[model samples]
Each structure stands twice: as structure tokens, then as C-alpha cells.
Target: MGSPCLKTVGAPSLEELRNSPAFPKSEDFMKGPIAVIECIEEIPCNPCETSCRKGAIVIGDPITNLPRIDFEKCIGCGICVAACPGLAIYIKDYTYSDEEARISFPYEYLPLPQKGDVVQLIGRTGEMVCSGTVIGMQNSRQNDRTTIVTVAYPKNFFDEVISMKRIKNKS
Candidate 1:
């Protein structure tokens, strides 16, 4: 016979999350374009829900089932990148001035790229399709180790560009 030990988990409180940059500010995310989170892992995660800062994503009761992103309030800031532990959260602004759309996601790897840098675009399955540009990158203390990378792509492929990679050239 053995003693039953309690599991220890360090989940962030509602108040401590306020200072997080990934968290928006209020219940005002943005309208137009929908973000699809493909990382489907059930863990103690509220980053996606709290990432919005707009009350857009709601885990509600279970703390899983993927947070429902509210279109209207999403500002397309891509703050969820730093918030999601499974690297599931991303932003898709399909209505980026009608002609073009922007996709923002988390990127943590070697050699951080600067703005205007072109890189290989990847999908949910980790397959490369096209090339994209590094429009923005957010690396703050609050984001922890996650780096927010915003990529600009054609409106047609807005659904394809979830992330980017610099595949060593393979020459």
C-alpha cells in the first residue's frame, strides 16, 4: 500500500494574466476573417481564452474543447501566439483591406528574422506550400519564450499560412 500524492499544477490566475501582452484588453477583438487553431491537445490551458483579452474565446467549465474565438472583438493582434502552450493559437485577418490578408502565429527557432524577410510557409500538417514575408515579430518578457510572427500572404491562401520556416536552403 502507498500514499496518494496530490498533483501540482501552476496555472496562471485571472489577475496575473492581465499584464500579459498576448492578452488583448477588453471584449473587442475584431470583425472579419476567422482563425483556426489546429493544435488539439487537452491540457490545463486557458491561454487561448485569456489571450483575446476581449472575452472572445471561452473554454467554459471544462477548460478544453478549444476556445471559441469571437470575430467581432478580435483585433487580429495575434497575441494568442505567446499565450497558447501547445502553439495552437493564431490570427487570420482575411479582410486585410480586401485584397490581402495577414496571418500571425508563434515562432521559436534559430536566427530570428527581421521585417521584410521572406520565408517558407507551412500548413497544419507541417508541409511547405509557398513563401511569405515576416511582417512583424513581437518578443516581449510577457510572451515568455514564444515569439509572435506576423506573415502577409495572398487572400486566397489566407487559410494555408499558419506558420513559416527557414529550411536551411538544403543546397
Candidate 2:
């Protein structure tokens, strides 16, 4: 698979990500689940910060500053996953198993996929990266209408699979 470091890839390039203080260390990505805040822009948003119970996310003055995550304090509860209006925050578990990993992201589309349903995993640039199985889903009034869906995918696509294709509901 090609790298996501391309600036035109629609996702933040690896080089750009490395320059950000909010970027999580590569070593930190493997220690169980953690919020992968992909808020590349400097927009004024901080719902993820208020949603984090551990204070792992911080958005200092200007309020427009990108949120930084302290991986050490992040419990990866995914509360921030649904809190982000931009739908950029995600929960990833690289240590799920020997060959499989899982990702949880905010899914707003209707007719949510059921557990065990296989779906195409999409990459950072909206490309089909691979397939994954729905493992869990959370929908509640507290989360508003954002449904946090978790899916299991191959461990190899840890960096590629950022989301899944939203299937159109059958008539």
C-alpha cells in the first residue's frame, strides 16, 4: 500500500503530523486503544476536550489551537470520538490481537451495520483499503445522533484504515 504522507491525499501527511505537538508518538499508538485526533485545521473546536474525562485532550488559549492528546493519560474510552463535530477523532486499538486490530469512529449515517457484518474499510483519502467486521456500536441520547461504531480489521492496515464505507439503506 502507498503511504499517506502525500499532501494531496486529503489526510494529513506523515511529515505534517510529525511536526505537530498534538501528534501521538509512534510508540504510543500500540498501547491499547487511544483517541487519534486528526483535527488538522486550526478551527475553534474543543468538544473533544470537554468530553475527555482524563483530561488527556487540551486546547489552550486562542481556542482555535489544535487539541493535543497526552497518550499517557488517554484511556481511549471513545467519549471524544462522538464529541467531535468534524468527525476527526477516532479510537484505535493496535494491540487488539496478534493479527487483528480495531477502530472506532463516529458514524452518523442511518441503518447502522450490525455486529459481525463485514464492511469495506476506507483509507484516509476515501480509498478502499480493506475489509473489516463490525464488532460493536454505541448510540445514545448522550452522544446525540453520532453512532460510534467499532470494527475489527487486519493488523497490517493499522495506519491505512481510518474509516468504513457507509452503506445505503435497502429500500
Alpha-carbon TM-score of each model against the true structure: 0.71, 0.91
Cα deviation of 128, candidate 2, in Å: 0.0
In model 2, which regions exceed 4 Å deviation?
Answer: 1-9
> Residue 170 deviation, candidate 2, in Å?
1.8
Note the Cα lDDT for every prediction shown.
0.63, 0.87
lDDT of 1 at 69: 52
Q: How many backbone clashes does candidate 1 have?
A: 8
lDDT (10s digit) by residue, model 2, range 1-171:
566654556678756766776777779987899988777788888898898999999997889988899999999899888888889888999999899999999988888899999999997778899999999989978899889999999998888788999898799
Error of 1 at 31 (Å): 3.3
Q: What is the C-alpha lDDT profile of model 1 across 23-44, one tens digit per residue? A: 3333322354444455433556
How many residue pairs clash (N, CA or C atoms closer than 3 angstroms) in each of the candidate models, in the order given? 8, 0
Q: Top model by TM-score, which number?
A: 2
In candidate 1, list every pair of residues with a backbone clash: 26-54, 27-54, 28-73, 29-73, 29-74, 29-75, 30-73, 30-74
Error of 1 at 146 (Å): 1.2
